[model samples]
Target: ETVDGPPGARTYRRTLRLPYGIGIAAVDERPGTATGGRGARPGGWLDARLHLTDPRDLTTAVQRLRRLFDLDADPYAVDARLGADLRLAPLVAARPGLRSPGTADPEELAVRALVGRDRAALLVQRYGKALDAPCGTLTHLFPEPAVLAGAEPGGTLGALTAALADGTLRLDPGADRDAATAALRALPGLDDHTVAVIRTRALGDPDVAPPGTGAPDDWRPWRSYALRHLDVAGEPQPRLARAGR
Candidate 1:
């Protein structure tokens, strides 16, 4: 979908794997050619992806995405409750707003998160054009905190990046969700959004609040999964840009 708004109005799209007997729907502003834009480039954008088990639910999922961005929207009725497959990507091109990349390696998305806007520009600048030297780096989900911690200001990563890097402060695999949240909260510069990313990715809790917000109690243990449901069922979307990646 082509989402226009703010100075950074973004476009999103998704790649579909239409399998027989299964339903699938995806929307993107421009799934192709997004990666080739960013840093000194004016059209840099972030790409997000969501998949549903039912194909008839595409309209519902697209609506939630619109509402998440604060556009006046209404969605259809659908019941998609799978989360393990939702994929989100951001195209950090040097542009005013961002566009989504079709389907890319999770690692590239991870690097985009590690090196945010200001710093990502610097990284691109450091390469002295071509935005190369690390154009397509990929690694595991929930990247090493230290990797983000090492980012240079505005040029490497964004604010509160350090807290995300702290080993003790970050949530790792199989960690206690509550304790992880507390630790993240203790970090002086830890932003509400970063903390939420830690909660969901590190702990795999899915209970992490979007940005600084909290999830409904009834959605516990599968909040992330529930989010996909709402996203596909045309339910209200959460304000997540402020929370996690």
Candidate 2:
């Protein structure tokens, strides 16, 4: 949830589900006044504060937030690499630190990928754990894999959740990307597109070229960012006659 703050500032509040218990996070953001002079770059800053029920979980919570916001990415190096391609040069110049987003909870992202937004919302409403103290419209934590598995949702969702709950498939941050991709493919009713989305976003693989985009070899290790630039430029390449790796 968001509310107006002091002039030019925006404040956001939300409840977080941590390993031990629920926590709350608040962030205040405003434009950087230091960047207003002639030839100064346009930029802003934010102050993020977290309240945890268990102080021992502080490290884990901070690490999760880093992944959620892609803060560990080395933007300068990524920009240098991707800027070499003329196709992506302009985009790189426009957004120097563009990052491929990572998930705070990989399992949650996988479930959402299997079931689109509408169905996911329904699942959340039905199975999500209510917060001890609700914050604005955010009243519940996303349903856990065990809860969804017990519900025994029909078809692909059921299979996926069961695998996640039982460890047949792992989408955790430390999971091996190739193994996770193979496991996802073995599941019935999961298409290549869905698997690719899971592998790239949920698994945090930065080099994935979705099957058939004809991504060049030069984009290696950074193809995901290149793909985003192509998509934003409305210049997606046609499916290659031979599929891409």
Q: In lDDT terms, which candidate is top?
A: 2
Residue 211 lDDT in candidate 2: 77
Backbone clashes for every candidate come to 32, 0
Per-residue lDDT tens digits of candidate 1, residues 97-127? 2211111212222334444656544543443
Cα-based TM-score, every candidate: 0.36, 0.85
Q: Candidate 2: how many backbone clashes?
A: 0
Q: Global lDDT for candidate 1?
A: 0.39
Per-residue lDDT of candidate 2, residues 1-245 (tens digit): 24556765677665567888777777665454444778654553356788888987788877766776677877778888889988789988876777787766789889888899888888889999888777777777889898998896668988899999999999878889889999999999999989988888888888888777778888878888778776767876535776469
Task: Give the lDDT of residue 13 in candidate 1.
Answer: 35
Question: Model 1 misses residue 79 by how many Å?
Answer: 8.4
Q: Which ten residues in a row have the lowest lDDT in candidate 2?
A: 27-36
